[model samples]
Target: MAVSQSSVFSESARGDAALSQINITPLIDVMLVLLIIFMVISPVVGLNLDARLPQANREATAPTVPPLQLVAQADGRYRLDGVVHGLDTLRSALVQSAANDPERVLMVSASADADYQAFANALATAEASGIRQIAHGQ
Candidate 1:
């Protein structure tokens, strides 16, 4: 009887080749089971509470005093509430208005062809007259 060592070694090497490669069937099954468990429990984990938000009042309150409108014209004159006023007159009026309510807003507007100097003078006058809130308009 002749014993071949090469044949025995070859059979063992083939068995090791199969063992070296990883089998992923059990890993895939475990992942799918975890995914299903998370999907079923996700909805129940959220809080379900009834909340009551405060509603706004439907009543409309009117303003006590109307806003002052000032317009700078191209002729170097200012218009206060549609009345044209000279530089000195505009200053006096602004001072009187500020005396009434210093917190009131003065809306200053200029025409497309209005003088830039006039607009600047109007803003300066308002500031000098103690009018704190000044708004620009088209």
Candidate 2:
């Protein structure tokens, strides 16, 4: 029998030990599973909010009643519809007006020499009285 090196040792046993190619099938499978899970869950996570959109109407009518007018005077007084009112009475009057016509507009006119505190008070009163639309005028 002829004994040779090829017969005695295999290719890996020949001491030519170099690094082999890495097996990446398991890593690729894990990544693909994660991608699929995210794809399935993304839409469900984004659909959390439910909202009703407003409809557009062609025949929206303007308010028939005139707007409520409040003027701030220099002496810390407020005038509503040309009637001077104290701070306490102004709140009650504004509340009554808002209750009477919920859709009515409020126009606040502050004079050049008016007190800033008075102007702010009148604005706050109107808002607290549930007047939804308030405007500033010259």
Candidate 3:
């Protein structure tokens, strides 16, 4: 005897639109990877702020326009022309100096062992104060 198969799947044949649905698995994976990357990098950022300074010669010809000297010591003290100034007042004082002489320039320098980041910060702060002519080194 032969058996007959039933036609149970012969209706309208419609189902959920699987093709149009979004797959979030890849999205989640990418997001997780990015999260881990950010976690690893967040702590390392802004930590290495010290700059390595270069050697200066005592017998170099000076430029026609003098540059106001700013120094950062290894101990984190900031000096404006060898006079110590607090970090809080440094920016404002530089601004005032720039305002008095709009064409003012500054020489940014620090010891080799000093925090380079501090020197860079000082330079940025001075530039922000509108010192028109800025230079680095002695």
Candidate 4:
């Protein structure tokens, strides 16, 4: 009779081969637990304090003086208080008005067909004449 030897290790059990796939089961479990905790605690953590905000006065005071109207025409002229004036005359008039009342507001309106240069010139003249407050009108 002859005695035979058998090996217990298999060829697939070799340690030289590295793991190619990653296991995400633990990561998914942790993420689900965190999501559940947040959902359960979010309502308890919210603030429900009652706040009293200060109310503003709704009454509006009327202006002491009416605003001066300046309209820019398409023909490169300006209408100040319904009187047409050239650029030089407009500058002089604006300067006079500004001297009279420095707080007076000038409301500028441009005609639909008015040149952009005319509008810009009107603004520039108003600023040069020491007018502080200027407003735009439709």
Best by TM-score: 1
Q: Write the per-residue lDDT of candidate 1 for residues 1-138, one digit (tens) a residue.
A: 886999999999999999999999999999999999999999988868789888877676546576799999998889998888999999999999999988788999888898788889999998898899999976
- In model 3, where do residues sit more than 4 Å from their true spots? 1-65
lDDT of 3 by residue, 6-59 (tens): 433432233345555889999999999999999999999958887989988867
Clash number for candidate 2: 0
Tens-digit per-residue lDDT, 19-45, candidate 4: 545779999999999999999999988
Candidate 1: where are CA atoms >4 Å away? 1-45, 48-64
Ranking by lDDT: 4, 1, 2, 3
| TM agreement with the true structure for every prediction | 0.58, 0.55, 0.50, 0.56
The sequence of per-residue lDDT tens digits that candidate 2 reaches over residues 1-138 is 887888667765654554455678999999999999999999999886878899887589664787888998998888999999988999999999988988888999888998789899999988998889999977
Give candidates' CA RMSD values in order. 6.9, 9.3, 19.4, 7.2
Residue 5 of candidate 1: its Cα lDDT? 100
- Best candidate (score: lDDT): 4
User: In angstroms, how far off is 137's CA in candidate 2?
Assistant: 1.5
**CA lDDT of 83 in candidate 4?**
90
Task: Give me the runs in candidate 2 sitting further than 4 Å from their true place.
Answer: 1-63
